[model samples]
Target: MTLPLSDSALIGTCLAATALGLIVMTSGGGGAAPTPDTAAQTETAASETAAAPEPSLPFGAVPAAPDAVDPEFGAQVRAYLLQNPEVIFEAVAEFERRTAQSQGDMDAALVQANADALFNDPRSWVGGNPDGDVTLVEFLDYKCGFCKRALPEVKALMEQDPNIRVIIKELPILGPESELAARFAISVLELAGPDAYDSVHVELMEYEGAITPDYLEDVASDLDLALADIVDLMESDAVSTVIEDNRALAQRLQISGTPTFVMGEQMIRGFVPVDNMLQAAAIARQ
Candidate 1:
């Protein structure tokens, strides 16, 4: 049996016991093991680790540094890009291919919508086979250098392929001289015939000076056409309507320049080689 000490002495004994207990527990010699609450906390942490989402980084790869991306990665990418510069060209080619396809589709749709005005307008000069299976439509300006160059190629095509019908629409956008030439040609076709118009067309295309009324009278004289008669016919509302209708058709078909060709659903926007023209005509036949 132990006797009770004074209050101060009792307090000192309690403090000593507490310190000894701490030392024993630290050394694993005391019976004061982990409490139930601590054990539960440890188990809970382990469970959370197993249930958490997996990281997005690939296996065996370390996480990127927080301060910056790896410099070597960017350098390697740049070096690889420089080594394969043709990739940019290939991308441009693909873009152009898609753009061409889209433009072709739109042109085809417009052609179909305005087929009557484009293909069968009686006002336009029609050459080659009148009842041909395939028809080639040409939008031309009298003063265009390309149109002048196209004269021989067109003549060759008609001579070679008699079954290909060629319809010419005079789009006089160059200047007054061009309109004068077109009006003269239209008057020739109206007064004389297609043969006279075709003959005058060749002559006008070959002419190498500013086309004035005097020059036109000379062309009429060469073609055996009455100059006064054609001059009177040129001023008629009938001739003007033909040119105005062609202008409207050009607007609808989006004809921005001269020497544009249309065969079936295909539209050749600029000067393509004679071989390409023949190829387009053949495709139209099919």
Candidate 2:
């Protein structure tokens, strides 16, 4: 797969994310309800609304007031924006100022880079191999075809390199199928131990298409594991918690898709080249 968007990518993604946020806010950010106003309704019927939190909106803050532009025009803008606001002029200017300042702080942040403190703990990536030196975290979707294709590479890494610890992170983003598969995967891990985790991991990844309860059962049967046992595990609070932990970690890592890798201090998101991965391992060892 293609490399995820980095700095520049983040900019566009953040903007798009902001736009979507605005839509949601307009729908309702959960503040005081708006009253019918001349701007929103005809002038014959005016209404008032408490200040809305438009932070989620693109550019941040509510849009221009009707009095500032044409009284009528401003009212129209305000009416729409109180519901749907854009930073436009003022917000853009401020966003640039604050953003530059935030950028300037990066150097200080980098200076305190706690490489080992940050990465050594597997809990940082959810339940991972805390003891392994070359810790490899894989963000995967159970329903992803590419993830299935990538399973062999992952299995080989663990089998061949004892020191190379691999953390299988479930990032089910395809749909509800993905989520259910993930829930089931966790249940298998809890009941079957690490070996079961390995078996289920490989089987799910190796198998293709929209994963379901049936596929899970089929795989379980092949592995001589009972479907009921796994299904019961799926309902366990601990299993759900682990999946939730994985989801939270993925968000913190800014992981956008499946097959992302974190080995040593470097994070290689997407399908990493074998030689490149080897090089990263070498660096970690040194």
Candidate 3:
């Protein structure tokens, strides 16, 4: 008949089995059988050896000797684990829960430490409700497919909830093209204004073609902004500073991918559905 084990008992049994295996493996096995005379001599030698004083150890430490493995106990542990495989799954699930909770706590601390840079940076464009109770920050690269996919979901989130403030951080990690796109966007924000930057931001998110000077010029022309001035300002110290600062912030927050969202204290590492976002927002509000 099988017997159930408590969580602590189960873990203890597994640990004991591991230690037993190590001890059994290290202890030499299958020695030749001793003759009657050899057994008598071995007993005499053991008596003399026991009578001798043990050498002194530093710090009055006692010698640690591994215990002999109980074959019956090892068999029982093996049988229990095999019969109740669900226990392993339960243990794994519990481990994952704890790990996720720990990571969430660390992310919350990180967010709190860098709240001003994340939520109130003057360089980044602020959309949705600026005075909203809840703030959502996104670190994105224009060339990332996930970022493109996330744009609509973000838009829908703002539309559905008018009180949600959104902050955009340009993190161009894809390549030079992504960097150029970000530079152009930052320049638009600095040179023109938020309205112009907002228009260009959407256009860039929606644009499927390659990001080139010609394409950027066309975008500027459409917005009735001077492309020459934008181009000149794109490579300036002001634009470089924004990108550098964003990269530093991302490194500090351990964000290595695009479409990473910080909704309140929670950090969503990748693209998630709108419902999940709303749920996170709701949780954040509480």
Candidate 4:
């Protein structure tokens, strides 16, 4: 049996066979020299060649027998790719798609691994259904615009779906004032209660500028909560420890941005439309 030849080997074989054919043609002693009629026939052949159909191979490739596939096939593939460079873009797109799928899978696994800290941390403020079938844990910073945007969506979700629980984890990475704001929110939630905490949370989240002691006092007074008492609670170890624990939990879940939402086995980073959030909650129920 004949061994299968590589592209390069097949090309070499074709070239050798061509050279042998040429040698035999040139050295044939029985052949007569071309007459005027033969020369006329040669001219006719050259004229006919101009009208021949284009080869199946791309332009610029040397014509070869069908069996010539060693180095010649490699060359053909290279030539075809050079002519259509967009193939590279298609390959890159496929790679990115696969990478995104893999990352999503990994994030899901990580979320499952850290479910206890993510969904049931006593420090996190649990809103919506206290015993809801699905829990959506949000990592938030008061100063994050996206987080603020998501607040209404969170509220709407809770309103529309009474069985879906929302867990708030304060991740104050914006600045010192953000930390203070988170500390105060956590403090109010821990010291006063969820109702009071919800009031302070909405006011703080809606406030425009810097969150100072005087500003917080005004907000506290509006809710009939003493600012001094809230400040004292904010400064205490319990509130600080809870925020620190949340930070640690965020790190474990590979969360690096605010307004991240985790539910079921999926971790959604960045702000998404309310429809998508609702869809995620629905998926969790299934």
Candidate 5:
């Protein structure tokens, strides 16, 4: 006998049928009447089913199908998730925290592996204490506004703590002007030495005017250096190699912007105040 089912019973039956790999078909009215040949074929099939022998079952019983999910439990879980949406936020926050931590660890490893190139590259200028206990490396671009802002903070950091060694990596990623400025500075270092490069570095960082050949030549003239010689060396392969190496190093460290500082094992991206730099220096000392 067929019996009517409630909503819950219908849901349960659907779930059970799905788990049992059974299809539940419904019809609003009787289907088309069967033809004589169809009826005869159906009778023959039924007679063959009755004549067929049943296959042996394991332990004299048929295997059970997987149990269906409890409808009440599923409904309760859906309701709880909808009411407490903050649970999703909490999960997202946790995921971000773990991701940041993993990134930090990977960065530290990269720093350690490239320590010599980072701290002791003879081509790069080394400012502050030569025998400092801790080293702070900055990847800077002359055209970067934030790098200009970070200049005084870095100066203050070195002045306040004499034990910090600062290394500048000339990363001219901004455009033509930035490249011109970096090439000039490195060329100065190559020909006239670190002292002349220091003079040009400070002037470029503080100069408010646009970067051009005349501006660089004027700076060289002010510093009492051979403007013609520095300009000539700017496009030389030696100067180009220094910039190329710095770019490769930045790529390895995943540094895409200027004023990125590597204090010991910790990396500080973008511009930060002197206070934060000081704290990072202290942490590096440890």
Candidate 6:
């Protein structure tokens, strides 16, 4: 039997033990004899724990207790995620923030690069008048709320500046609805003329919330346009091809959002003031 050490002695003993541990850890004696066995055992245990996986959805964040889509699948996913819900959520948020930030940074860099490729492509710019002195290229989605509100301003800009041409590149990076609407709009461009495209463009932007097939059809009819023609063209691969092209260009240019404007060499984003646009357009003419 051993007598209990004084508190000071015990404290000194702990520090010595810690120092010894540090020495062992740093000097490679950590892997000697039984230490190697323990290290391997610890590594194996960690590997197994990683292999086993925690709950996927994390604690309390599982979609539903009894999932309709394969009960086993939900359970397995949740189990894979485990009690790390906060970690998962934070990870996702951090990823999005980082990705958006990186994209924003890359966008500035890419826009400055010599045009080996282009965001809208030089051909899409052809949508504007062939000989127009000033070209205004817009990277827009049909579903963006801000784009709709800015329609009057867009129209005003177009009206005030006749020589200023607008290139409406259907960069539908928002969601499925945005893509569909953009496709439909492009098809409508084929069905009708620039007027119809502009009318439909303005109308769709003015609409609030999610755009559906039925509402889209109604909007087309309201424009005194032929729905059958637009629908046929919308279903065609041409729309898909154009959108794919737009996505490629956006990826190259790093345009992640709607209503990004390229007036001459300047890349102005969002709903810029009309006065600012007027200033920019005037400068472009020069």
lDDT of 3: 0.87
Q: Model 4: clashing residue pairs?
A: 6-70, 7-70, 7-71, 8-70, 8-71
Clashing pairs in 5: none
TM-score of 5: 0.71
On lDDT, the stronger of 5 and 6 is 5
- lDDT per residue for candidate 1 within 63-156, as digits (tens), equals 7764522234434444554576555456556766787799989988998999998888888888899998888999998899888998888888
Q: After superposition, how far is residue 224 of candidate 3 from its true place, in Å?
A: 1.4
> Over the stretch 1-286, how does candidate 2's per-residue lDDT look in tens digits?
4467654455556765655554444443232234565336733333233344444567666766753223433344445655644544345556667876674354224323633433443332333344667766677887777677676666566566667766676777888888888887777666766777777776677666667677777888888887897888787887677667777666666567877676665666667545676777787688
Looking at model 5, residue 45 earns an lDDT score of 92
lDDT of 1: 0.80
Choose 3 or 5, whichever is better by TM-score. Answer: 3
For candidate 3, write residues 102-201 as lDDT tens digits. 9999999999999999998999999999999999999999998889999999999999988899999999999998999999999999999999999999
Could you tell which candidate, 3 or 4, scores higher by TM-score? 3
TM-scores of the candidates in the order shown:
0.72, 0.55, 0.78, 0.70, 0.71, 0.56
lDDT for each candidate structure: 0.80, 0.63, 0.87, 0.79, 0.82, 0.69
Who wins the lDDT comparison? 3
Which candidate number maximizes TM-score? Answer: 3
- Give the clashing residue pairs of candidate 2, or none: 36-47, 37-46, 37-47, 38-46, 66-74, 66-75, 81-84, 148-205
Let me know the TM-score candidate 4 reaches against the reference structure: 0.70
lDDT of 5 by residue, 1-286 (tens): 2359854456555544543331111111222234688768868997998899966688868667745333334444445555765555565567667877998899899999899999989998999998999999999999988899999999999999999998999999999999999999998888998788888888899887899988887788788988888878998999899999999999999898888999999899999999999998888887
Tell me the lDDT of model 1 at 18.
Answer: 45
Q: Candidate 3: RMSD over Cα atoms?
A: 8.2
Ranking by TM-score: 3, 1, 5, 4, 6, 2
What local lDDT does model 5 show for residue 10?
61
